[model samples]
Target: MQELSNRTSAFTDSVIRRMTRISDQYGAVNLSQGFPDFDPPKEILTRLAEVSMEGPHQYATTWGAQNFREALAHKQEHFSGMKINPNTEIVVTCGSTEAMMAAMMAITNPGDKVIIFSPFYENYGADTILSGAEPIYVPLIPPEFNFDANVLEAAFKQGAKALILCNPSNPCGKVFTRKELQIIADLAIKYDAYVITDEVYEHIVYEPYEHIYMATLPGMRERTITCSSLSKTYSITGWRLGYVIALERIIDRVKKVHDFLTVGAAAPLMEAAAVGLDFGDNYYKELQNHYTHMRNLFLKGLDDIGLKYITPQGAYYVMVDVSEFRCKNDIEFCEWLAKEVKVGAVPGSTFFKENVNHLIRLHFAKRDETLQLALDNLSEIHIKAKKR
Candidate 1:
């Protein structure tokens, strides 16, 4: 047998998914993966059932279905304050995962450098590597999860071809603010670099912290590539309907990359999810309220349990500090948490490019009962999770 590709030889199974398996094995309340344990919106579900019977069950088009794209464009315009040409500016993908991968492939060449913030979503690192590009990591300082403008400009000064921005970031759950995004937009413009934004949690922002579209920032519309999905907004993670919105010039390349990658997103799923795209502002307001309730419910339980964590501003994930447990490693502590505490979490080290192991990431995107149960199980952590 020939040698395996070095591009992926060093890869380990995703710590998040691996923890989910461990949680299942131990019958622990799984919070390792960030999906809701509740049902999607009733309207979307009803549409899905109807689409199942009267089917566009086969492929729609290489880019996307006309109705789906038009609906997405209308919805995007309603929120983003920008005109979008559904035919030329959008490429529907299997998911934001594919949307991101296709966008990276379209824009990067071997040896190109992409600036990625530290403690990023695990996939971004792999995406840069698989695109044959190098990553320049700039740390988003903890506790507040803010980055220094000077350090960021230093990363840009390294001739970075692009920057990956994950707003309402995963693992840490820090929402990038408008001023912060403007700093990024300025640097990107100064360096003539592309800004690839992952805004999946665009509608799940809590009060006082707004979700600003990076593309909406001054001088960014042309160079920004927006990759988002219906998964988080509509609670349809399995539907895998996502898309990339960019200038027609960039989207042309992305369309080719996406077409060869997955052909197109599922036609029936797209049709069903298109209903969600047309949802009025009230739907988003309710979504924010629902996630806000979940966040408060879960964090309040943590407060009662005397656990210290970084309060999330936008996303549903919280980084729980476990340095008091005196564990040898975060990975071991997480495993023990699943087996003994009966709750699942991902080691904070899995998401960091630096040496950070005193934290663990847990999500609150579940039913109130499910979150309460996890909290009930976690209440014993102080004693049960004590290091040997």
Candidate 2:
């Protein structure tokens, strides 16, 4: 029998979404995926209702809704300390997923090398493959999840055309310090390669550990492609709103790619979200405070449980050290954990190219009650693996 595309033979299904399914199978508390289990902002809902009644229900402008672009420019400039042109620097996309794909399509050619930090957000690997680019995996070594500057430079020396930077990173939750970002900027500048940054967690940072826009770094604005989303921020992951920002030249190319890929983000959703894009500073302050509370609650729980883990500086995830359990592999441990403990986690191997499996990632983007339930479930952990 003939098979499906061999291009995809190396890929398995998303472990994160698979965990969601497993949770369904067992009624487990799923901390595997990083999405909020709550309603989106009330204003966004209100605007969505109004948009549902009114009909621009058709396709928005191919690049984006004009209002959305304008709002995004304003918001980005305010945070980044760099003015962005609404007309030439932004493309609204389905999510950071599409924004990033558009970015890869815009800048990369087949066989180009793109550097990805290890234990990265999983989508990045698939993005590189499907975009026809080869990935150079650079180890952001564990515990503190810091990368050695010389090793990172080595990846660039190997003819990498771009690097995917995930600030306030997802699985490991390390916010690149300003000094660290400067070092990266210097490298990208020296290499003359593009910097594609995934900054969806821009506002989900903890106090005293702020997220720096890579594009805002000296000599980086024109060369950086920033992919960001409203998914995490507004608790509207399903709404699938995101955008790409670059210098006019890169945006010109990405807009063409995005046009063919998604033909613009959803029309009515984009229109409704323009209102959210303009939400006041208080909205962001409240967002940070809410995520801060969740971070504290979960990290404190891990501390009390005596779990060895990297304390996240930002983002909604924590990468825990599970070496004490004497696991054969992370996948087996995670499966045993789900069925036996009734709480799901993502095996750290899925995010790494190396043989390291001493880690597991969890999300705290749940309601307090839900958080408490998972914590309670984890409190009395006992796992003698059923299969291993």
Q: What TM-scores do the predictions have?
A: 0.99, 0.96
lDDT of 2 by residue, 1-388 (tens): 9998766789989988988788767777999988889888888889889989995798889988888899999998998899899998888899999999999989999899999999888899999999899999998877778999999999999999999999989888888998899999999999999999999999989878889899888899988999999999888898899999999999999988988998878898988888888988999999999988988898898888778888888889888888888887888788878887788899998889889888999899999999999988888674333334
Local distance difference test scores for all models: 0.93, 0.89
Worst 10 residues of 2 by lDDT: 379-388
Q: Give the TM-score of candidate 1.
A: 0.99
Expressed as tens digits, the lDDT of each residue in 159-224 for candidate 1 is: 999999999898788999888999999999999999999999989889898898999888999999
Off by over 4 Å in 2: 1-4, 383-388
Cα error of candidate 2 at position 251, Å: 0.8
Identify the candidate with maximal lDDT.
1
Q: Number of the top candidate by TM-score?
A: 1
What C-alpha lDDT does candidate 2 achieve relative to the native structure? 0.89
> After superposition, which runs of candidate 1 have C-alpha atoms over 4 Å from their true positions?
none
